[model samples]
Target: MKKIYVTLALSVALLLGSCGNKNNETSNDEAAIAVEVNQTTENQTNALLSVSGKIQSSNSADLSTRMMGYINKVYVNVGDQVKKGQMLVSVNSVDLMAQKAQVDAAIVQATVAFNNAEKDYKRFKNLFADNSASQKEMDDISANYEIAKAQLEAAKQKKNEVNAQLAYTNITAPFSGTITTKYIEVGDMANPGMPLISIEVQDDYEVMAMVPESEISQVEKGTPVDVLVKSINRTVKGKVQEVSTSAKNTGGQFLVKIALEKTDAPILSGMFTTVQFPITQKSDTQMVLVPVDAIIHDGQLSGIYTVSQSNTAILRWLRLGRIFGDQVEVLSGLKADEIYIVSADGKIYNGAKIKY
Candidate 1:
């Protein structure tokens, strides 16, 4: 009986010791999950929205003719400066000049006929009143006078039409600008509505950018902007001059114009540029900032792994705001001074033990 009790006691002791060892091993494994985390904070940063575009002149035009004729002379060359109303090109006017001469001769002939008819009508009217001329003779004189008056009026109209045609032979500058392109040379057939020369207004330029429809509201007219020319390695300040009320056909983006302040650098038209629009939300609340990679996406919702007071990872869905470089603005779900997992291998889940 004494041996039996001793054996039973030893067996119970061994079983209890094995259970204790297993518990300790499990605890060690649980404590080994240490994840590097970072504390999130808020900072006042100027929110910037970047968009790429091209620099263009404030006013540009492709000059063309309305009448088809051979180009007689191209007075301005590429890179030439011209003033408003300055003659830029000329068309062959030989036919127009001959037409003008014909109209002029017609005018003189009509005037002479009108004068002779007027004298005859007055003399016949006086003879008819004195009963010396027949009624038929007076009627014929009156008809001749009327025909002469109509002819004179037609001749004047022809002269005016010919003069207008003659004026079309000369092409004048519509505005003060620099000639950037010449599409035709002397003796080239200048077709109607065909572009002859391209001119751009000097001393004024604007940067045009296409903004996504989601960001169009934040960009308003007169808003300040920063323009960067990558090729020239230059940055200049500008303002939002205009915003399109409608969307573009390609990508449903709205066009935004930034009028650049004049700079000494030779910023030519059609230069590629990047524009930065500064936006500030009018809110009395503060926003938190975190690394871009710290945020995780689950379908359409964004979330982040936050470290709880017990050092357990807890997933919290986040509402994000404007993105600033590598940092993102946390509009909600994350608070300032909260600890969040920043370097986890994405294996950490909710309620998981974290050592750091």
Candidate 2:
């Protein structure tokens, strides 16, 4: 009886062990990776070409002097608003003033000489006609009158030149604008060609961007673009005002000028900006489309997560084309009606079980 009881216990123990192992295997098989997925579709959309640039005033100038002198006074500060022809700076003009005085004295002397010569010439002409003066005397008087007249004209021209130089001693605004930069101060020695101040027209602004040679052909004058001023955190509409025919000397990139629409918001020059150029390329065949978020970077190559027919996750490498807003055009390595992983809360890999 004891042997029979021991045999029954051994059989029951073996059966329990087998059942536990089978349950563990079933649990492992049921485990799957959970991720949100979407099916790609074909579409025709205008591709957006994004290029970075800087905000600049459509009318900006680096105000400088043409004559060298010590700065006597700066009437405007960095933020001063000035009108066209308004005096902004005054250089040391004592020397210029003295020079003008000398010119004035010379001009006065020449005027007096000219008057005397004219009177004498008239008198001599009358005397010669009346036979009171000889022909030799009239010729000599005429030559003296002509010489005095020439000297008087030359003196007047010299005075005018002196006055023009005197005007330069007082620098004036070329246009109505706000002073953005002040490089010269009182008592600073300023030289010709040295920038003294900078001004920008407050109401006029534009964005300047560089485009590569390959993309320059797509950008055309009058094409509308979207400009984003990151500093202001605002997006504005702009039009292509000008496109350079030749490439830049340094980078070989072509320059593109975009004129922004007038806005009440304060848009200053030299602010960083991003410009989005809309370019459309027609194709005989449709292209596959996927959200920009769906694409992943794999160190020099672009790829996306795709689902296999068996509902397993697989990483697919793709050749991408133009980008359109949130969607990107897929040139190859993907097809229409294909299921792709859009979002995953957990780590995923190739051959990983995907749960819908």
lDDT of each: 0.87, 0.86
- The TM-score obtained by model 1 is 0.62
Judge candidate 2 at residue 145 and give its lDDT. Answer: 94
Q: All candidates: CA RMSD in angstroms?
A: 9.0, 4.4
TM-score winner among the candidates? 2
- Could you give candidate 1's per-residue lDDT for residues 1-356 as a string of tens digits? 99999999999999999999999989967665677888887776556777788999999999887778999999999999999999999999888889888989999999999999999999999999999999999999999999999999999999998888777789889899999999999999988889999999969999999887877898999998888888898998899999999984747889999999989977899899878888664466366888888888989999998887877889999998866545778988988888888876448788887777
State the lDDT of candidate 2 residue by residue for 1-356, as single tens digits.
Answer: 99999999999999999999998877755657789999988766567777778988888899777778999999999888999999998888788788889888888998899899999999999999999999999999999899989989998898898788878788899999999999988999989889998988878898999887767899999999988788897888999999999984838789999999988766788889878888775666477889988899988899999988888889999999755555777999999998999988678887888788
Cα error of candidate 2 at position 252, Å: 5.4
Count of residue pairs whose backbone atoms collide, per candidate: 0, 0
Off by over 4 Å in 2: 1-43, 212-220, 248-253, 285-356
- Worst window of 10 by summed lDDT in candidate 1: 278-287
Largest lDDT belongs to which candidate? 1
